[model samples]
Target chain A: MTDPAVEAAIARVHREEWARVVAALTRRFGDLDIAEEAAAEAFAVAVERWPRDGLPPNPGGWLSTTATRRAIDRIRRESQRMAKHQAALMLHDSTRPDPSGPVEDDRLRLVFTCCHPALSMEARVALTLRLIGGLTVAEIARAFLVQETTMAQRITRAKTKIRAAHIPYRVPSGQDIHERLAGVLAVVYLIFNEGYLASQGKDLLRVDLTEEAIRLGRLLLVLVPEDGEVAGLLALMLLTDARRSARVSATGELVTLQEQDRGAWDRGLIVEGQELVRERVRAVAAGAGPPGRYQLLAAINAVHTVAPSSSDTDWSQVLTLYDRLAALDPSPIVRLNRAVAVAELDGPAVALAQVDRLADGLDAYHALHATRADLLRRLGRSAESRTAYDRAIALAANPAERAYLTRRRDQLRG
Target chain B: MARYLLSVFGPTDPPASGGSSSRSELLQEWADTGAFNDKLQREGHFVFADGLEPASTATTVDGRGERPVFTDGPYLETKEHLGGFWVIEAADLDEALALAAEGSRACRGAVEVRPFNTPESIQALLDS
Candidate 1:
């Protein structure tokens, strides 16, 4: 039987040091598969040995050394069996630390590698969750609603491609850093969105995915603290997630922002998110680089959190931020979101005009029709509002959203 | 270390009269090409490098059927053709790309770098 103390210590190491240990091993071995496998074997050994030998003061170091030894043994065995000179050379390299350690954080290099643009977007997410997030293939598969076999195959294919293509296991430098950072941020936000508004499920939210994304966001901040966008992304997720409890009614019906009880919002998250936004904005004002899209979005969320109630929301400020966002990224979704702020600040007529302009582009987007429905209802065009609601209900995939739209449509008919 | 094939592609037609080059310009181009080849050789990265004849003189062979077959010209009908190539050794893709950039500057044409797949790399993929 495993000792309870050892179990707890192993769990803690799995949670905190998995990525670090895997990263250090990966750098040393120059192979992700070996690194991850060795790390797992080391953890397995720890579960058995830590119970008997007592926990080491430097658990990460112990784990790294153990994993390295396992990797060396495997490499040597493989080389001897296959007579592969390259494998033997790699084994020799792995046994010695480089005189010059990595200049940048190894975890950051691992993150960049996991999110490399060479891989498909889905592969990038899976790889990041598996490698950096320390999620098992089964867990990632479950989160993505795919078979365990499919996720495993995807991860293996990605790793194989990384090896075959010789994708550098290093953080990109100069202009490439900004471009690559976008990819990393995009993966994190995509994970957060999957959690915030699940694409398909009976439940409206996946708290575990959300927490995981926030954890990654925090990790990125530590890895690249100078990046204002990273801080902004973490803040955006925090402020957006602060209303998790208030986002749904008791019966699991979707609660619109205006209907949610502001008192139910997590004040701690709001305070923390607001502080981050303020710091980023202050830094920008002091001649730091201008706020990126995520930073601007966080600023918008900060505006919403500062309001005591929905009606008291600073609409003009929100509208201005939306305009800025629309300028930065003129996607139909951004314009659709901007229309809502327009409705609040500039009345239904103006907002309806903006929404109508987006009709052709956002025809398939459920939120576009929903926003139109709300604007029409506000303008007392009950029949038009009902029609818009019908479109929205048909397009919406989430049960909560569909039910909410159905209720609204029924009220209009009445 | 890995071996990369740096394939250079260029248009079949020479420069037009409006883009005429002077004698000095031709000499400078030759000088640059020589310097690039020398650098690769000096660095012990050069395995083989050579320019190719135009595609018009090339022949195509297809043997998917029972008997062999032959075609008149290059396989693909494209404006640009493979003009030359260099096989060089490099530590990794980054070095390969950097070397390709120098080759591109030397040749004044697009250079594509592709790593050679050896048995060891294939084995590594399977092991991974």
Candidate 2:
């Protein structure tokens, strides 16, 4: 018999409180494996007992306490085999002298751990998804775009490194904070990138990853409230998320902004995003520092969202923001986006000139070809446009992109 | 809350062959360490502790299901094999870090601290 009560409790444990509990227990139990085992034991107990006895008022707290006790017991049992086990007992004894107060913030500690610089970028993403995102190895593997076995090994190796190096579990301070903060942002950005454009799969977007990234951004904002850049990043994500609904048609076809139904855009998200951006800008202007890449991106997005129609978009403002963004973070991708704004504000010829100046490395890039084709077609260069469209079609990876490119080719021929 | 895993690694180089007296002294020190572990168990903070054999004895298995390929090597090809580990719970990273120091002293080797994944994180990924 499938017990609804037990199932519901498990769902609650997994959804609403598991990370908090695990973090709290992990704070007490220094070892990841032991902490995991103890937390599992607590969950097992909850499965067996929660149904019989009503769920505790604070299930998370109960789980944390239970897991802590189990960890202590496990430590005691293992003490017999090694010389250092005695010291382990001593440390355990000293720490548990008082358990009356509420459990400290384990989630914050977890974030710092996930963002540990000792781990590689891949390891950091994998570990963050594993520990902070609470994903299974198989799920992480899928998100990682790799084999499950490979991901599992990566995770295990990462854990071994943690065990071997004895990486501390706390938020860094002073100068160390800046370096660690970058690691933290990188993981958050990685999650957002995956959501913004899934590298594989049929879909262009993964809303779940996007939403999760936003959630983590929100959490980061809470943890580091004074950081205008963090606020800026949140605003940027919100603005991007606001456009998700209009990004595609009901049939899952890609819908460019000019063609999208402006009415379908989420007004609430746009408003929230605008306020966040405005607040961050004001804060930065007041003396926090210069606006960051995220702030600039948000400013550009705000221009788009504030406009009543596609034609009403403040191209000048977008161009200005793009210029600032490019200056702040010079990248080929940023230049590509800037070219679009230049095309609108100036002319196809100017945009084409700008594109030509870009490095030859982008010759194989689909977006480069796509943009060239669009510009060429607008200039009435049909044969050149068709050739560019063909190149785009060849370089395009996603089905929607291929279809879009093919459609452009047909239009050029017509 | 903070969590850390403290581990002590055995030296890569084996103890040099020596006369009986030096060997006896090393064995005595090893025995003292064993009793120290028993004291740790009674205190109730130990998660798991195991002494691994030399790196040469390690066998790694890769792949999954039907054909898990077995290879004769440690998971990490490095000389630093995991000799033993203990998971300790602490109130914060500082506290967990302090325990790591103590762990090193007890085992006569280095100790590492790390946090575990929480279930919330697992669901967060699922939600993503």
Candidate 3:
């Protein structure tokens, strides 16, 4: 029988040390498949032995050493010609004495590998959640709403491509780092979005996914402490996630920012997020570099968090940030969001004109229709508002969002 | 070093027949392609290069069954057909992709790069 303590230890180690163990093995073997297999074997061995004998003093070290040994053995067994040379290299590398244990952040290397631009965006998401987050293929498939076999094939293809393509197993440096960082941040934000507003589900929030994204953000903070953009991303996610409790009404309807109960917001996260935003903004002010898109976004979230109520929100400050954000990234979505702030400051008529300009590009986006509907209602254009509401309700994939839009449309009719 | 195949795909429809302007455009394209191949040779990235005839002229022989079956035309009906390919050696995928990007400009068509797997790497994957 497995001891409860041993089981708990295994679970904890899997959560905390899987990336490190796998990374160490991958570094040694230079193959993601071998590294993962070795790590799995090490965990299996841990389950068998840890219960019999008490847990090791350093579980992570123990796991890494065991997994490394397994990888070496596998490599040795596979190629008789290269066995002696490979075994010698593995033994020499594994036995090196270090006073400071596991000093290098192997997880960071794994993060860069998973987020490499060579792989497709879907592959990056799947690999990040699987390798870094320690989630199962089945779990990842469920999260993406794809067949387990499809996810498994995608992951296998990605690993094979990485090996074949020889995508380096290290954090990028120089100009490449800038491009790769965007991919990394995008993957993290995608995870948070999946949690914050699940693409297709009855519930508004998937706490597990949100918490996982936040955990990743925190981990990224530890790995890249000085990256203002990294801090900005973490702050953005935290500040936005802080309002999770207040984002849905007790009756399970989607609640807009203005209608949400401010008392339900997570004050601790707001404080932490606000502090991070201030530090990053201060760094920008000191001429580290111009504020990135994420930093400006985080600053906007910070402003919203500090406000007593939606009305108390500094529209002028929000407008300024939105203007800067629009300048940096004039994406349709950014302009759409800026229009909301414009509606508050310059009135709905002016905002409606801006929103109308975006109609062609953002025709399929539900938020675009929703924003237009809100502005039209304020302008007393009931017929146009009802039509816009219908479009939003039709386009909205989330059941909660669809329900909320439906209710609004019904109210307009009444 | 790894071997990569840079396959250039061409539109299915035959080239439009027009006057001297169209003929000159084709000549210019061929000249640009010749210059690209010369660059590849100078850089020592060239392994082998070849341009195929139209897919309509191709035949497929399947050996998966007990008896091999011969099929007419290309195996798959695709909008774009493999027009030509280059086998080049590179240290890694990034280098291969960079080379393929240059090849794309030369060929003036879409290029797909795929790596050839070694026996040992295949064994490693199978072992896992």
Candidate 4:
């Protein structure tokens, strides 16, 4: 094999086997730092030897064996210098032999451990991407717009906390799985949101992040097939992602949902997402009267996706679902979304009232100002609308959204 | 198995319970807590647990300098002060957290759980 072919093969296998190999190493070694370093060493060796020796037929198996040996070597080298190396060896006896870490999937155990609540939310997201998603520290740092050293420190601190605090490596038991799963879902959703709208940056959409989040969501579904919210979250992401291309105009301006061409939407993703929405809804109706927040959000997205045009959307259904979501979350963000539905059903004047009530709570949120600007524009309050658009454009980070808002502000009659 | 420190924190300005009925209520609270302590000891999770005196009684002592320094008020001044704490042994963080939850409910205050350092954690620091 040539160098390029070997590199490609190594990259492909690295993406496929990183989490599995690391998880297996962690399960065996009971130490994340060792598992991580050993995996890196194993990959480097593959890069060095695979070109000369030809790619191994069972690359993943070979990588796993090599990484385990590296970890063993690491422990031995360090153990020789320490006085209490015997005790550390016992501590490394694998954090309570899991009754298979629930499904014998090492990847699932790794994901859950990375998303443990003991770590800060940012740390959890960074660690999840690095450890389970197999993203390099530099890539994660770039994705989150943080310095490489900062991200490295964040990951290191989290690993230290996990070991020092004795966070178990196995998935939470039946009694605690639901509560723990919520934390894991929140981290994934945050990554998706960062990709969806993005922070203050030149790029409006982070395709890599949205893709990574969906991948994690799919993995979660396989690990916990019975979890309705897992299905709901995946559905919501897919439904939202279907409109990614139409979200930005060819001329480099943001396209609002009302302006996006529904004809260009991804039919396959829409179908998959709507199917999950149906399953979640049926399960929720049969079991509990109120669905989880993700389920309701997915249902709301289902209504929008089913509509041929924004005007044809079922505003009443969207409003009802938003109301339910507000009851559960009571967040200003939910009310802002609910106000969008109200704008369609009632007059913009009514929606403006709701948005105004949220002023104190969402003063710094760019979407709030954007929504208010649109409401004012619809009400023919040109001066107020112009002011609101200016506020939104100033607060907005995504260059596309800023350009779109800038055009709106300039278009208004003085 | 590991040891954890579950510290109960509450607002510094607790409502002054001076009336006779309030005093009896406090007594009843103490009785309930006493029963909880007994249960912990019976279950082998207890090491030591105690409620703290008011923060006003706390004095500060700093000995890092050549001569030790004594201050009048509590070492740390904050809106919320440590009201009490428990030193309990449990298997892993989940067990410790569960125990802290029950302890928090028993004392009617927020509890913060932290693990005591082990040989590995200390070695990790040295090795790093």
lDDT of 1 by residue, A1-414 (tens): 677877888888887888998888887777898889998899889888888999999998999899988987887788633466455447646655466974567899899999987689999999898889888999999888889999999999899877766777887878779988998999999999999999987888989899999999999999999999999999999999999999988887899988889999999999999999999988998999778899989999999989999899999999889888888899889888888888888899899998999999889999999999999998999989999999999999999989888988898843
Expressed as tens digits, the lDDT of each residue in B25-120 for candidate 1 is 656766887899999999999999998888888999999999989998899899999988999998766667778999899878899877789776
Candidate-wise lDDT, in order: 0.88, 0.75, 0.86, 0.88
Model 1: lDDT of residue A291: 87
Candidate 3's DockQ: 0.39
True contacts kept of each: 0.47, 0.11, 0.53, 0.74
Best by DockQ: 4
fnat, candidate 1?
0.47
Candidate no. 1 TM-score: 0.82
Over 4 Å off, model 2? A1-16, A44-52, A76-104, B1-128
lDDT of 3 at A411: 81
Q: What is the TM-score of chain B in candidate 3?
A: 0.88
Lowest summed lDDT across 10 adjacent residues in model 4 chain B is found at B119-128
TM-score leaderboard ranking:
4, 3, 1, 2
lDDT digits (tens) for residues A170-264 of candidate 3: 77766777777878999999999998999966778988788888888888889888788899999999999999998887878899998888999
Q: Who is ahead in TM-score, 1 or 2?
A: 1
Tell me how far candidate 1 lies from the true structure as C-alpha RMSD in angstroms: 5.1
Model 4 misplacement above 4 A: A1-6, A81-102, A285-290, B11-15, B20-25, B63-67
Model 1 chain A lowest lDDT segment of ten: A80-89
